[model samples]
Target: MADIKVIIPAYNEVDSIAHVVNELPKSVSEVIVVNNNSSDNTVKNAETAGATVITELRKGYGYACLKGLEYIASKSKQPDIIVFIDGDYSDYPEELDNVVAPILEDDIDFVVGARRKNLREEGSMTPQQVFGNWLATFLMRLFFGAKFTDLGPFRAIKYDKLKELNMEDKTYGWTVEMQLKILKKKMTYTEVPVRYKRRIGISKVSGTVKGSIFAGIKILGWIFKYSIK
Candidate 1:
């Protein structure tokens, strides 16, 4: 069986973290939850749910993910696939098998869990978030001839291929950065439609004006920078 590992970057996701940890498919060998300076019981809850939790004081989605990668690196046996999913229960964790299917069964280097509009719960995504996803994807198609529909956080990539990308984004640009790099490198990738719903708690990004603005800026900045490159 191919070994698979999952990385979840959490902030104050106390209510949702345990559900995300416990709902993962059994195919996953380990679930690494990186607590991104959560002030809640995220760590305790994750531990109680039988997850390997770690602390990443640096407060960024990329920082928490990188911390999880560092932990996996220290392990004697590395996973064949690395899955990245939000700590929020908005994403259906049981579909992790679907997310990694392309890589495992088709030899694709990466797989994105695309949240199609029809599959998403109404009000699950903010108006700005929907517009942002549309604009970003439109730009990607214009500049890179990419076919990505959504920059969904639930995605999977091969371990070796992931290392080759040398991802360095430290904030909201993480998802777009990965897609851009995949395009730049001409890597084999695909998207699998996945169901989505409102999270257990308010989103730290889309729920706040400042968070949404910064995230939009970061995402656009990366796209423009890569387009010029």
Candidate 2:
């Protein structure tokens, strides 16, 4: 069996961090939670749940993710695969196996868990999220010739290939950055249908009208930025 490590980037997620950590599968060899300047007990709660907690004082999703990657790289024996899951508990931890199964068994490099829209609870996603997904996917297909649905957070990838992607988006652009980079690299990737639900706290991006506009601009800008380069 390939060694698996789960990386969760958390920020002020005290309410859901512990539950998310506890629900992860035992098949995972290690869980690394990067506390991104959280003002709550997120770090303590995650540590209590058996995760190896790391501190990323810099406040950004990319900062936390890069910190986790650094931690994984420092391991004497690096993990064969690394799974990125949100610490917000909006995603189902039980479905992790399905997300990584393709990569593990078939030599696939990446797997994205596409949330089924119908399965999502009411108010779990705002109207802007639905439209944004449509617009972004459409733009990616039109510009980059890449097809995708639901840029959901629950995803898995081979460790070496992730390093090759050289991800560096600092804020809301992180998810789209990964997608665009993987496309540009021509890596093998697939999407699996996964369940979604409302999160314990409000979303930082799509929860507010202003956040939604900024995120939309960033996502579209990245797609076009890479397309023109």
Candidate 3:
């Protein structure tokens, strides 16, 4: 079996972090939850749920995820695959096997757990999120002939391929940035339909006007920047 590790970027997800950690499949060798400067009991709860918690201090999803990657880089034995998931309890954590299967079985470089509309619960995604996904994906198709349908966070990538991408996004643009880089690098990728539900507590990105606007800008900026490059 390939060694796999999970990275979860959490910001003030005290109410839902534990559930997300506890539900992860046991095949994951380590569950690293990077607490993004949460004032609540996020760290404590994640630790109690058997996740190795790290503090990013900086409040960005990408920052927290980078911290987790740094921790893995310091480990004596690195993982074969890295799976990134959100700590909002919206995604079915137990379905991680489905996310990584293509990489393990077919030697695919990347796999995204696409939250198909048929599998998503009502209102799981906000209006802005839906439109933004559509626009960004449509542009990816138009510009690059990419087949991506959703910019879902629940995704997995080969460790070496991930390192080659040199991911540097420190905020809302992380997911799209990865996708764009994958396209530019000509990496093999696939998507697995996954179930999504209303997250526990409010969403940090889609729940606020400021977050929505910034995320939309960041996502579109990555697409357009790559389109011209």
RMSD of each: 0.7, 1.1, 0.6
Off by over 4 Å in 1: none
Q: Report how far residue 82 has shifted in candidate 2, in Å.
A: 1.0
lDDT of 1 at 165: 92
- List model 1 lDDT by residue over 45-161, tens digit each: 999999999999989999998999999999999899999999889999999998988887899999999999999999999999999999999999999999999999999999999
Which regions of candidate 2 fall more than 4 Å away from where they truly are?
Answer: none
Against the true structure, candidate 1 has what lDDT? 0.94
lDDT of 3 by residue, 1-229 (tens): 8899999999899999999999998899999999999989999999999999989988898898889999999989989999999999999999999999999899999999999999999999999999999999999999999999999999999999999999999999999999999999999999999999999988889999999999999998999999999
Candidate lDDT scores, in order, read 0.94, 0.89, 0.95
Off by over 4 Å in 3: none
Q: Give the CA lDDT, 0 to 100, for residue 62 in model 1.
A: 90
Worst 10 residues of 2 by lDDT: 116-125
Worst 10 residues of 3 by lDDT: 57-66
Model 2, span 129-205: residue lDDT tens = 98988888888889878768878889999999999999888778888899999999999988999888889887777
Q: List the residue pairs that clash in candidate 1.
A: none
What pairs collide in candidate 2?
none
